[model samples]
Target chain A: MTIDFKQDILAPVATDFATMDTFINEGITSKVALVMAVSKHVVEAGGKRMRPIMCLLAAKACGTEDLEKHRKLAAIIEMLHTATLVHDDVVDESGLRRGRPTANATWNNQTAVLVGDFLISRAFDLLVDLENMVLLKDFSTGTCEIAEGEVLQLQSQHQPDTTEATYLDIIHGKTSRLFELATEGSAILSGKDQYREPLKRYAGHFGNAFQIIDDILDYTSDAETLGKNIGDDLMEGKPTLPLISALQNTVGDDHDLIRKSIATGGTSDLDKIIQIVQNSGALDYCRKRATEETHTAIQALHELPNSQYRLALEKLALLALNRIQ
Target chain B: MTIDFKQDILAPVATDFATMDTFINEGITSKVALVMAVSKHVVEAGGKRMRPIMCLLAAKACGTEDLEKHRKLAAIIEMLHTATLVHDDVVDESGLRRGRPTANATWNNQTAVLVGDFLISRAFDLLVDLENMVLLKDFSTGTCEIAEGEVLQLQSQHQPDTTEATYLDIIHGKTSRLFELATEGSAILSGKDQYREPLKRYAGHFGNAFQIIDDILDYTSDAETLGKNIGDDLMEGKPTLPLISALQNTVGDDHDLIRKSIATGGTSDLDKIIQIVQNSGALDYCRKRATEETHTAIQALHELPNSQYRLALEKLALLALNRIQ
Candidate 1:
């Protein structure tokens, strides 16, 4: 059965979602016109507000009644996410995100880079106002790790020798680490110390699964469905999971092809690379791994008490997994 | 009197400066090789470490003998400065800083942007360890303003109508804000509440004078002397103080020439524009403004107690003004 996002997941926290969304708009208000303009453009281009929703859901799952602080935290999470995307576009040199012109495209790399910095600083500024030292420490360190993860991914770029363990490290930093912060940060704000670990675990595994699925789609999905063209990662020479797994499963020309493709990025061998990544059972291994991660993530959610919020969180994980199936 | 940097300014805090410099080296240690490499290159390429030296001087002026926490604060200030420079090079698309290859030049814009981000996060992480909420709030707010200042400058780019008031706002956000943070942060760390406002005022004015002098030098100094080419700002169509002052003082052909130069950036009429700027008394106006700012900065220092550290701070401000002479 197909699980509808609004009905099965986001329904429970719809009010909080609206509140958080409003808070984000208010939070990005700046004295500088350009900062506000670029921030609005990128924030509006946001897809689904998944991280903030996860934050709200985790807050509710912790049995917190006062979500006013959680709403602010959710807004901070979204701003951080938006800031990274603004920079990521500059790094990736992409013009469109979610079918809209990116900040880099709308203005220039200078504006995009500086505005991204503004968003990050503004996010931290708001986080400081939360007046929670524990939460501040969490975000301060978490953001550092997030940056290191990004740099690590850059270092790993075009290096075909990158391992699965290294790949996990890359994905954890680039994608899952923020998700961990969203849920873990909510638990911190809720004053639910006991829930922090389990929430972090659930989000971390869920993030891993989510990114793996995204990487898979890079090899499989067409532009019409994914908004990203096929072989996009290979084009960039990014040694993502499909390429890594394909290298492990193949030999001779297939192995050399995957390695060369990673070492020398481009979509010149797009069809053959896609064909090998599919026929070599690499997609099957990746799907199985994604499913395992999702299962672990949902299992961690069991640590919290039964509630509609918890159910929604579980459904969210399952829904992500369903994309692959 | 010739104010030698090492003898007149850095001498008082020489030992503390040494310790603080080492802390910066150790503080930037990263698990990611590229992060470390790029961070080390840029941090090592730093010139005079003026901001940190000011931080150290301010802490010493507070009559704080321990000098331990102040060292860390100074290091944090330098890291923040380095981070901005890294991002600034990317924004300006600069090839060299202080005659050394920029991170963007050495690696790529992508590396520079991400590494700069890592530096910012690491700086905040270290600040969090300082465990001063008031200081954290100051820095968080200060960084946001710095970014806004940068965006404001970008917004005013190539616009001939930009006023001195707008120029002040841009310099305050981009330049003075960090100086304010450095000295004010030192006061905050020194636990000297009474000195915070005065220190902030002093640094704010000093930063303005420094930027104005730098802008003036853009028209007067060349690559061999200043390490920056003459007309570099004009090449980018930056509406700096000299151009603003030139526009204010001229009219008819002279005014139109300056305005056109600003509106359409290039060094095509470099000789003519330089001749106009000098003959139009724009340089005299900028010098007078810089001197006035420096005097106000020195006046603010009167609030502090009489000490050698305070003397060094005064000398530092005077030494900056001496550059144009």
Candidate 2:
């Protein structure tokens, strides 16, 4: 069955999500005009508000009805997510994100970098207001890991020999880690220690599935499917999972081409590589792995009591997997 | 009498400074190899460890003898300083800082940006261990202003109309705020509520003097006074104090040239611009302003009891002023 995003996933927390949106606006208000302009541009260009919605849903799923603080946490999570994306655009040297001009492209890389720094500092500033030491500890250490993960990805760039293990580490840092923060952070704020692990586990696997699907889409997706062109990862020499799986499942000329593309990044072999990836059974292996991760992610949600919010979260996982299907 | 850096400024906290250096090394420890390598390169390329030493001295000034915790706080301050410097090099596109290759030059912009982020996160991670809500709030808020200050500076770039008031606001954010954090952070950590304002006042004025002196040196001092060459700020179209003062004191062809050079950033008019800036009475005005700021900085220290540490703080301000003597 096909799932509608607004109906199945965001609908449960739609009102709270609206409130959280205001907090994001309030949060980025700075005395500096350029800081606000770039922040507004990037935050408005956000896609789906997935992390914040997940945060709000998790709070409701934990048997908490009032979401006053949870809404703020959700906004903080999105701000942190936006900060990373701003920096990532600079790192990748991209001109556009989700069909809009990126902060780096809108302003210069220097402006983008500094504004990104402002967003991060502001996110932490709002977080300190929560006044919870435990939450602070989680985010502080979590951010360190998240940064390490990004550097790890950069280190893995242009290297075809990057293993699936390394790819998982990269995705965990650059992607799943934040989702874990989103859900687990909500659990922390709600005073539900019992749900923290379950929420973290669920979000972790969900993030892994989400990122793997994104990597898979990089090979097979059209502009409409992903809002990015195919061969972007290859153009940058990024050794994402699809390429790693392609390396594992193929041999002979197919293998050499994949390795060469990763070693010398560009889309010179774009058509050929896409063709080979489709036929060589690598895409199938990636699909199977993504499915396993999705199953694991959904399985962890059993630890939480049944509720519409829980059902919505489970549906959210399935909807992500549905993209690949 | 000349103030000796090792003897007059850092001597009171020299032992604590040594111990604090280890915390910087320990704090940067990461599972990611590149994070460690880049972090070490930038941190090791530090200059005199000024901010951290001031933090230690401030703690001592607050009558805290056992400086185990204060030592860690000092390290955190240095890490934050190093993080800003790393990003600054990227913003300025500088290949060398203090006669050494910068992180961006040694690696790449992407590596420098990401590693700088790691250092910031790691710095805050270490700060969380201090377990002081007030300290956390000050740092979180201070870092936001720091980033804003940086953005404000960027906005003012290449604009000849930038006012002296805007210039002060820029310097306060970019330089003085962190110094305030360094000294006042020590006060907060030491539980010296009485000394917080005084220490903050001292550092604020000291930072103003320090940056104003540095700006003056950009036009008047040779390469030896500062590691960079003369006309560096002009080449970048930075409306620093020297340029702003020169604009205020000149008219006709001299005024038009200064305005044009600022509007179109290049050192083509380097010799003439320097000639006019020197004869413009701008350097004298800047020096007088620097001295006034240094005096106010030293004056703020009287709030604390007279001790060797307080004397060290006073001498530190004088030594900074002595550079342009």
**Tens digits of per-residue lDDT for model 2 on B43-146?**
99999999999999999999998999999999999999999999999999999998999999999999999998888888899999999999999999999999
**Model 1 lDDT, full chain set:** 0.93
Query: Which candidate ranks first by DockQ, i.e. highest?
Result: 2
- For B1-325, candidate 1 gives per-residue lDDT tens digits of 6999999999999999999999999999788899999999999998999999999999988888998999999999999999999999999999988888999999999999999999999999999999999999999999999999999999999999999999999999999999999999999998999999999999999999999998999999542443588889999999999889988888899899888888899999889999999988999999999999999999999999999999999999999988899
Error of 1 at B321 (Å): 0.5
lDDT of model 2 at residue A237? Answer: 98
**Residue pairs in steric clash, candidate 2?**
none
**What is candidate 1's TM-score against the reference?**
0.99
Would candidate 2 be rated incorrect, acceptable, medium or high by CAPRI criteria? high
Enumerate the candidates' DockQ scores in order: 0.90, 0.91
lDDT tens digits, residues A1-325, model 2? Answer: 8889999999899899998998899888888899989999999999999999999999999999999999999999999999999999999999988988899998999999899899889999999999999999999999999999999999999999899999999999999999999999999999999999999999999999999998889998552564588889999999998888888888999999999999999999999999888888888988898999999999999999999999999999999998888
Taking the true A–B contacts (Cα pairs closer than 8 Å), what share appears in each candidate?
0.87, 0.83
